[model samples]
Target: MNSTLLLKKLYKRNLQPVLTDLKFAIALLLIIALFSITGTVIEQGETLDFYEANYPLHPALFGFLSYKVILAIGLNHVYSTWWFLSILVLFGTSLIACTFSRQLPMLKVARRWSHYTRAKSFEKLPLSTALEGRSLDQLAPVLAQKGYRLFQTDDKLYARKGLVGRIGPIIVHASMILILLGAIGGALTGFVAQEMIPSGQTFAITNITEAGIWARPWLPKDWLVRVNRFWIDYTPGGTIDQFYSDLSVLDKDGNEVDRKTIHVNEPLRYKGVTLYQANWDVAAIRFQVNQSPIIQLPMTKLQDVNNKAKAWGTWLPTKPDLSAGVTLITPDLQGTFLIYGTDGQLMDTIRVGGSSEINGVTVKLKDVIGSTGLQIKADPGVPIVYAGFGLLMLGVVMSYVSYSQIWALQVGDRLYVGGKTNRAQVGFEAELLEIIDRMAGSTPSLSAV
Candidate 1:
């Protein structure tokens, strides 16, 4: 019994106060906000080489942040770091403690109906009046008509409404707790991957760019994604307007399960994984040399060009000994290719299915195949987070309702009336005055003081 008493005392005096302190909760919130900002400012899940090039040590970023610091502190992935998750858990516990120790008790007190039995009790209320020659019988119906719930004894009465307002803070706290749980859940189980798949090619989730510690189970292993076709829409000025990829989901038996044409901001969701059309590239060039078999050569992006326009190019040998060749260059998948001779001079221009005799050979451009860049992600907690936000908005709206209460005491010839509201004080005052006026009409001798 002595040990139990000591434990209770320690909980009440030590652990409970710190967790219930508003300042501590606010401090935790500020710390979380600061770390969230840091996460946004710093790119997450980049390669070591990328960080080395961008945040070099010779002139470190901000004179302190370098690749070494980012790796050591896990700033490369802030949300999954142990310290950040610990802070989230601590903040959630603080909210739970505050709800139990402060908000719930306040709600309980508000729910319990009590009457101001003495005239002195009326003196402390924000809105109070004493009426002479008025009984409780004359005032009860007036308050009831004004939408005030009433409780009465022979000499004391209490009436209240908008009890739901008292529950709003509790719902708000609950929603915040749900949001924290969702964040933690996502941090531990979500995964992100990227793939650049050429048209007519099928691929699986093999290149994971970023993932949580326990994200392997969430990764898709039973299905494959096939890119049926990739095409782009160009504006009148030759700029890309939009790109699209027709995709199909295949089962292990190579049967199509689902199909969709996805574009930027329009993602395909299957099971829990979402595939977004993030980028595109020129994959390969298909052509024929002098009625030979159709040959497909891989294309690569060119660098160090004078013009900054993006272009992909490949070389095609026209002679058997590789003594003569031409470079095929195209800025986009517009089926137009610029042919350059061995001396780097523009020889001719060709389109898809068009041929040109160059360097003693007939070169035919069959097609230009494009690749679709897809960003895949699986996050199990997104629905929970959305639900939490919805509840938070509802709670905020509910909290605006006014919870007003009124009390009156009848002592033979006098009635003491007092009331208070958690919100909308002016409206509550007007409502109370209207009730008084109605009671005065029934008792002509009644006068408010």
Candidate 2:
């Protein structure tokens, strides 16, 4: 019995105070905001080589943040870091503590009606007045008409309205806790993968760029994604307007289960996995050189010079000795190619199925194969987060309602009336005056003192 009492005292005095302290909660929120900003400003889930080149030691970012520092502190993966997750957990605990220790008790107090027996008790109220020759029977109907729930005795009466206002803070706390739980769940069970698949190629989910420790179960295993075709839309100015990929979801038997043509801002979702079109590239070039069998050569993206646009290039040998060849370059998938001879001169420009004479051999361009880049992700907590936001909005609306209460007592023909409200003081005063006028107008013997 003594040990249980000691534990209760410790909980009430030490653990409860620290967990429910508003200042501590605010500090944790500020820390979380700061870390979120840091995560956004510094790229997350980048390779060590990327950080080494971008955040070098000789010219360190902000004079202190080097690749070594980033790696040591786990800044590259801020949301999943142990310390960050601990902060989230602590903040969530604080919200729970606040809800139980403060909001629930306040709600209980609001639910109970207080009966004032003496006239002196009403004197301390924010709005108080005494009515002469008034009875509880006359005031009950007035309070009822004003949308108040009444609790009455023989001489004392209490009335209250808008009790839901007191519950708003509790709902807000619960919503915030739910949002934190969803965030933590996503951080623990989500994964992001990137794929660059050529047209007509089928592949499974691999090459995960970022993932939580327990994200393997969320990854798709029974299905594969196949890129049927990839094409681009160009504007009149010869710039890319949009790109699309016709993708199909295939089961283990290679039977198509779902298909969609996805572009930027349009994604394909299947079985909790979302695929977004992120990038595109030229994969290979198909051509024929005079009586030679059709050949397909892989194209390489060339380095941009002087802020020039992106282009892909490939070389095709025309002679048996491989001494003479021609370079083919294209800036887009518009079926146009620029042919350059071995003498470093522009030989001609040709479209698909068009021929050009280079090194005394007729070259015909057949097709330019394009590859689609897809960013795939699986997050299991989005619905919970959305629900939390909806509840938060509802709580905010409910909190605006005014929770008002009034008390009355009769002592020898003298009636004491007093009321107070948590919000809208002016409106509450007007409402009280209106109720008094109604009581005076209804009962000819009642008059305000």
Candidate 3:
């Protein structure tokens, strides 16, 4: 008995703090949600270099106020934040507590039949009514035809229906709980990997945020993904028409397990993982160079050993002609270059890593590469979220649709009838008095009925 009392005291002590924490969590969740909406109205994930180039005059301020920092702070990835997740947990707990502590008990009480005085009290309600009847038994069957359960005691009658009425709020609250759970499951159990896989290439996800692995103890280990082909089609008017990818999932031994064609709206799912059409970008071109042997200079005894040795660096057209030779006058220094002749004479100057030409020699670049970016994800909480949606819809529909009833109390020859509804109390009251007039075969007054 003492332990039970102690437990109750402990629960009471924790209740206020838990409620306060829940309030804070709700406020923070609202702030985050508002920030997400505002961020959508703005832009996100722009580079410092882009901002500096675009707003050159106010580079410092522009860079400082840009969304890049927010992205770094994981606002672009807000649904995956630690605090956001914590809020989900707290919200779920509070929802559970509120449902169990308040809603459940009220629902239990609503499930049972109540006194006819309850119906009589509703006559003063805004949506209540009164009727003159010689016998309630005659009207009870009429109300039953209209889908109400009639209860009679002595001279008072009570009628009610839609016992599931109380489930509406419960279902609504359950949906919220399920939504939070689904979000948490998506954040934790779900894996998000982005890859710019070129057409006709297969690759494995080897990197994640904070150098995490693709396969955790709770996830699949041998899941492999491959992009067999990618296509981009344009409309006759030169607008984007369609974007798609031919993809496959592979087994541990490199055997194909599944294959499908995925488009912007359509995605490929294997096991629990899904590949989405996130975006696309251009890949780097391949560049190669042939080096010519040069004599190495030895450091002198008196030379400073800490200093880096400098050399001349240059490039020339790979041709059999003596028309041009690019010279690196000081490769070890800043990007300084000098064009030269076979006779070892200077022709023109250019910066290293910068494009330049000399004499009749011509340079060529080739092998432009491109790729499509895909967002790979796996989530286990989607069913819960969808279930929650179903429940919320049912709750909302039921909450708006309600049941109404009217009752009459007869003692000897005097008849007194009252009306009530689960909703629209004021309108129901006026309609009830109007109905009372029709039953009495005379107009009604507040003092004379």
Candidate 4:
């Protein structure tokens, strides 16, 4: 009864809750995975009408899954979600717990050799060996011949081989921790900003995630940037082949600090800020005013109709009258001609989209202003994120490429060898038997299971 109780205690203490921890970890990882996958599928940072019109089959559903929902629930943007961050924290905690609770003691045992008596229970283990009608003589020399360091205790034998097998979980956990550390480092210090600037125009990256922080104490004082020029290339089939921009950075004094040419794939890096060519548009049109320029009398109060007509500008196709006069109002891309014969009198109106003839003066629509769009980023933790990705890949590689073991013991005259592996033990066992047969200078048909 005492032995039974002792065995029960040993089992309870030695056994690890590895499977339960793994299940929890896997579920957390899957949630993060789902968010990542969904981020790719959904068109992020777009207007609600876009989703509603596009997903007309489920308009109400799309409306519910609008930007507000995404922003509130952290779905439109996944990486910065509080719940996602918490999951990562929990994953790291669980990994640390599993590592310490189970792997540390196993490593201690594997690093030290213990004596095992020739009892009936010893042969019951899957990779167990028993001596048949043989005396334990010269056991040390026999074990030494099979590359096992052996120690003896009265009637017991202790042997160990490939002790490094115990460190497999440690290495795996260490790499996972490294990856998690890298991710945390990145999340705490990453930011991205975007702006549109016309040629020969300057702009500052003021806002991120629609949140502007003008009073950031640690931000650079002179975060001014400029675009000297922007260019676009097209393919023969009218497709956008490539795009680039010439950008300049300035300090507080507005001195020519630095300059770089950034392109679609190529980005300019300075002071942790990277400038990329995001997109381009038309802005700031330069066109001629198609009317005679002159000044009109200023009448603050319209006491009389004649005085009110004199207050109008003399630039357009209008004659001075008590009621109306022509006023030429021209915008960049769209122009209009107004013919007012008196004050507050609608004589005639003409827009560029349509045609109008007033006093034989015709106007034509010209050009519009063009703009170059750029996306700038200053992520102090991008390198760390990349490092994390590399470490994660390394963990997978190590987990997949498992290093196994073979243990050979000499019982009397017969050489008994056993094999074990944390994973793929059957394949390794067959290979071990084949190696043993070859060492004995005989061909044994070892079938791989």
* lDDT for 229 (candidate 3): 71
lDDT of 2 by residue, 1-449 (tens): 99999999998999999999999999999999999999998888878988997899998888999999998998898988889989999999999989988999999999987799778887688888888888889999999998999999999999999999998888999988888888888888999899999898999999999898888899998999999999999999988899999999999999999999999999999998999999999999899989788899999888666435788999889987888788889987898999887787898899998988877889888999999999998888787888899999989888888999999999988788888999998898888888888875442222222
Q: What are the per-residue Cα lDDT tens digits for candidate 3 across 1-449?
A: 99999988887688735753656647756865775684475433334564444434444445564444555565545666686677678767777777787778877876666554543454564333343434665556656665777788877777776666767878877888888888787767666666778666778765443211223643557867778877666676644577778888888898999999888878988777778887754332222233323222211112135434433333444444634444434322223445566677877665534444445433322222335678766667788889889888988887675556555667566555655567776665665565454443564443211
Candidates 2 and 4: which is better by lDDT? 2
Task: Supply candidate 4's per-residue lDDT for 318.
Answer: 34
In candidate 2, residue 197 scores what lDDT? 91
Global lDDT of each candidate: 0.90, 0.89, 0.60, 0.56
Off by over 4 Å in 1: 1-8, 305-309, 320-323, 442-449
The TM-score measured for candidate 3 stands at: 0.67
lDDT of 1: 0.90
The per-candidate count of clashes, in order, stands at 0, 0, 9, 14
Decoy 4 TM-score against native: 0.64
The alpha-carbon deviation from the true structure for residue 40 of candidate 4, after best TM-score superposition, in angstroms, is 2.9
lDDT by residue (tens digit), candidate 4, 93-181 = 77787778777877786666554433443443345443343333434554457565566554555555545556656767776766666
Per-residue CA lDDT of model 1 for 1-449, tens digit only, reads: 99999998998999999999999999999999999999999988878987887788979988999999998999989998999999999999999999999999999999898777678878788888878888889889988887888999999999999888988988999999999989999989999899999999999999999888889899988999999999999999999999999999999999999999999999999999999999999999999999889999999987555435688999998987888899999989999999998889999999999999998899999999999999999988788888898999988888888999888998778788888898898788778887888876442222223
All candidates in order of lDDT, best leading: 1, 2, 3, 4
Look at candidate 3 and tell me the lDDT of residue 205: 66
Question: Model 2, stretches more than 4 Å misplaced?
Answer: 1-9, 305-309, 320-323, 442-449
